[model samples]
Target: MKNLLILSLLYITLQANAQGLNERVIKLTDQLDSIGVATFEANYSHGLRTEYIVTVSCELYDDSPAPIKYQDQQGNILSVTPEQDKRIRDLWRRSHESYDLIRSTSRLLAEEGTECYIWESHRNGIDSLLYSVALRDFTNQQDKTYMPDLSTNPEWSKYGGAKEGFILKANPSRFLPNNDMEAYKKNRFQPKSEISFTYRLTVEEEDEDTVYYVDYKEFAGMIDKVLQTDGVKSHPILITHDKGAKVEDFKSEIISCDITHPDLDGETHGTVYEIETAELANTLRRLLSAEIGNYVDRHRNLNYLYRPLQDYSGDMRGMFSSNNWVIRTEFHTKHWYTFDKNLSCRVLLHHVGSKAYVLVLESVNDFWLPKDWHKLKSWKNGVKEYLYLQL
Candidate 1:
C-alpha cells in the first residue's frame, strides 16, 4: 500500500509539471501575436536572455498649427514639417552639429565595447541643447563589459545571427504647444525629447543553456561624462526605497537601476525590478498607487479624478500562458485646460515571470497625451451627463 501511495504521488507530480508546461506554451502563443514570436526569438537568441519581455507602444502628437519635421544626423529630412519651418530648421542644425562632433571624437573603447560622443549647441539664443552619438562593438570576447550587442555577426552568419546598429539625438522642445507659451518662454524651450535606435547582433558563445538577452529599452536616456584624462564617469539613476520598504515588499527582486542624464534636472528616471509571486504582486500594485498618489499630491494642488477600469477580460485574456500580469490606473483632473472636462492620466503595470522570475511594468503612460488636440476643443462644447444605477 505504501508503494502504491508513492506511485500515485509520482503520477500526480508528473501531471502537474505537464500542466504547467502546457500553460506556459499557450501563454507564449498568445503573446506571440502581440510581440511577434520571430522578434522575441531573435532577441532571445542574441540579446540578454530575459524570462520576461516588456514591450511599450507609445504615440506622440505634434499639435502645433505648424508642421513638424524630423531629420537624421546627416541633415537628411526623415519627416517633413511645412508649417513649423523655424522649429524644424533649429532641430536640424542642432542635430548636424552633434553628429559632426560625434564623428570627429568618437572612438572604440575596446575591440568589443562602446564609444560615445556629445555635441553642445544653442537654440533660440538662450536654450542650450546637447546631442550625443554612441556606437557599440560586440566582436571583442576579452572585454567583460555587460552591454549586449544587437547587430548581426559575421561569424554567426552561418547559423543565422546578425549585428545591429543605432543612432539617436535629443533636444528640449516646448512641452505644451499652444496655451502655455509663458511657461515655455520662461524655460527657454528646455524640455526633454528622447530618440533611440535598436538593431540585432550575432555572436557564438559556448553553453547554449545560458541565454543572453540585452534589454536596450532599459538603456534609453542614459547619459555619461568622460574626463578624457581619466575614465568615463556615468551618473546613472539612483533607486532609493522609502526607509522601511524591503526588497520583498516590491513583489519582485530589484535587479538593476540606471539614471539617464542626471545633470539635467527633473528628468524621468527608470527602474527595473522582477516579481516573484502573485501575493507579492498584489502588494506591489498597492504600493505603486500610493507612491504615485503621494507624488501627485505633493507636487500639484489638483483634485483627483479616478476612473475605475472596466473588466479586463479582453485586454489580459491569455496572460497566464505568457506568465504575464497587467495592472492599469487612470487619474483625471479638470484644471489642465479650459475644455476637456475630464483630463485623465494613466499608468500600466505589467508583471511577467518564469520559474523564479518577475518583471514589473511601471509608468507605462507617464508621458502620453491624446493624439488629436482638436479633441480638447470638442470637450469645450459641453455634452450632457447621464447617470445609471445598477441593482
Candidate 2:
C-alpha cells in the first residue's frame, strides 16, 4: 500500500509539472509575439520535467529589431543579445534541416523521448517564418532485475556511445612521441589542439617561471590589439574571478591578471566583460575567422567525431570554466566531399595551477547534436589534461 501511494504521488507530481510547463509556454508565447519573435521552439525532457529548452528565430519587425527574450534552464529571463539570437536561430535551422542526415550517419535519435512545441508568427507584413519540429516518444524500458557490479566508474560511460567513445578515446599519438606512451596518452585529449605555437616572453619578474598553456594562438593577439586600440578605455569593464566584487559599472580599469579553475562545484563565480562596442567584437570575429578556417581544414572529415559547435554551446553555458576570458564562434564549410554547417571554435586562457598557464583554442564539428546532458563530455574528456595543466 505504501509503495502504491508513493508511485501515485510521483505520477501526480509529474502531471502537475507538465501542466505547469504548458501554462508557462502559453505565457511565454504571448510575451514572445510582442517582441518580433518569428518562430519559437520549446523542448521538454523527462529528466528536466519543469522548464523547456527554448530556441527562437526572429525577424526585424520595423526599422528596428524587437527585443528578443526567452528563459534559461532555470526559467529565468536569459540574457542574450541580437548576435546570440541570430546564432541560435542559425544553429537550430541547420540542426533541424540536417537532422535526418545526422541520424542516418550517426545511428542515434538525437531527440529520443521529448515533447516539442513550435510557434511561427503570422503578423502582417512579415514573411511567414517556416520551421519543422520532429516529435518522438519512446516508452521507458523496464528496469533490469540483474545488474553487473562494474565496481569502478566505467570510463566508456562518459562518451555518448561506442563510436564517440572510440573516436574520442583514440589518443593523439601523432603529436606525442611513441616512446613516451604514458605521457602522451595522459595529455592527449586536451581541450585545445595538441600542437602549439610557443612564445617565451622575456619577463622581469623573479617569481617561479610560470608556464601557462593558452588554448588558442589568437587570444594573445586579440588582447594585445584591444589594449593598443584607443577609445577602448572609455568603455572599459573590469573582469574578475572574484564573485563578491561588483561589476555594476564600467571603468577604464581591468582587474585580475590570469583566470584559474573553479572550485569543487565547477562554478567560476566570476564577472565577465561583455564586448559593449561593435568595433572590438568585430575585430575579434574577423581575426577568429581565418584561424577557424584553418582548424576546419586540418580536422576535415574527423569533424563528425569532434563536433565543435556543440562544444561552443557547452562553453557558452559554462560547462567548462576559465574565469575571465571565453570567446565562442561558429563556422561552416564544404570541401573534399565533406560538408559541415556548424563548426565551433571556443577560446580561453586558464591558469591551470601554480605551475603553468594554458590557453585553449577549441575547434570541433557538431557531428552529433546530442541533448543537453552531453555538454559535460567536453569537460570530462579533458579533465586529465586539465589537471596536468594545473600541475
Candidate 3:
C-alpha cells in the first residue's frame, strides 16, 4: 500500500513537470514569432513512462536591408549614408539562401535525464548545431528504481564527483578531423562531408550539483589509432561541456607525446594529458584559441573570442529584402560583410579535456559553383579530426 501511494505521487509530479514543459515551449514559440519568425515546428513525445522528448524548429524572417542612419560613437545620427544600403544588398547576393535549421531534442529520463540541441544553417552548410542540458531529481519523490548508477560505466566514472547532479553531453562528431582536402582543392569550394563518431562518458552526482568530467586523453588515444594510417592534418581540437559549470572544479593537461614524421601536414602528432579541478577553464580557453587561430588568423582579428555552441533559432533567421536589396542579420546582430569576406573557413572545435577534436563546419566554396548558375548549392566539403598523444 505504501509503494502504491508513492507511485501515485510520482505520477502526479511527472504530469506537473510535463505540463510545465508544454507551457515553456509555448512561450518559446511566442518569443520567436515576436522576433519576426515566419514558420515554426515542434514535437513532443513520451520516452518511457516518466520520460519525454521535445524537438523544435523555427523559420525566422530576415530584415537585413532596412535602411537606417549611421550612429557615431556618441550615439548621434552622424549621417544618412546610402553606403550601408548597398553593403547590405551586396551581402544578400553573396549570402547563401536556405533555411537555418536548428534541432534540439530533449530526453527527460529517470535519475536525471539529458537534453541536447544542434544548430546549423543551410546557408552555412549541412553541419548542425549541438548543445546539451542535464537535470537532477532531488525529491527522491520520483521513482526509486529510476536512479542512474555512474560507477559501472567508464564514461560516467570520470565524473564521479557529479553523482548527485546532472551531466549534459554534447556531440563529439563536431570536433573530428577534416578529410576532404583533395575535394576542396579540386572544386575550389568547400566540400560537404559526413562525420561519424561514438561518445562514451560518465557522470556522477555531488551535493546539489552534478559533476561530469571526461578522460580526454583516452578518447584522443583512440582517435590517434584510427587516424594513424591516413594523412590527416594537425588541426586544433574542440570539446564542449555545459555552460554553467565552474572551471575551478576540473583539471586538464597534456602529459605525453608521440610523432611519426611530425613535419608532415597530416602526420599524427600530439600530447596526452589529464584535466582535474580548477584548470578546466584556462586549458579550454587556450585550446579553443589555438583551434580558432588556425582558421581565422589571430593577427588579423584580435576580437575573435571562442565561439560558443548556440541554438540555431537565435542566429540563422531569414534574410530581409526590398527593391532588389537584401540584408542578413544573425541573432539580431548585423554582421559586417568584412567578417565573411575575410573568413577562410568556419570551424567548430569540440574540446574534451587534454584531448581535443576539430571539424570544418564550413569553408570557402566560391569556385565550385558555375558562373551562370542562379541557384545556390546547399552542401560543401570539410573534415573532422580527432587528436591525442601517445603515452
**C-alpha RMSD values across all candidates:** 25.5, 25.3, 24.1
Clashes counted in candidate 2 amount to 19
lDDT digits (tens) for residues 220-335 of candidate 2: 34444433443332121111222332222223222322212222111111111233344443343333333433333233222111111111222222322333233333333432
Model 3 lDDT at residue 103: 21
Tell me the tens digit of each residue's lDDT in model 1 across 10-70.
3322433443322322343344344322112111111121111212111122324444445
Task: For each of the candidates, give the backbone clash count.
Answer: 37, 19, 55
lDDT of each: 0.28, 0.28, 0.27
Better of 1 and 3 by lDDT: 1
Q: Sort the candidates on lDDT, descending order.
A: 1, 2, 3
> Can you give the TM-score per candidate against the true fold?
0.21, 0.23, 0.20
Model 3, C-alpha of 79: deviation from truth (Å)? 8.9
Can you rank all candidates by TM-score, best first?
2, 1, 3
Candidate 1 segments whose C-alpha is farther than 4 A from its true place: 1-114, 125-169, 174-183, 186-391
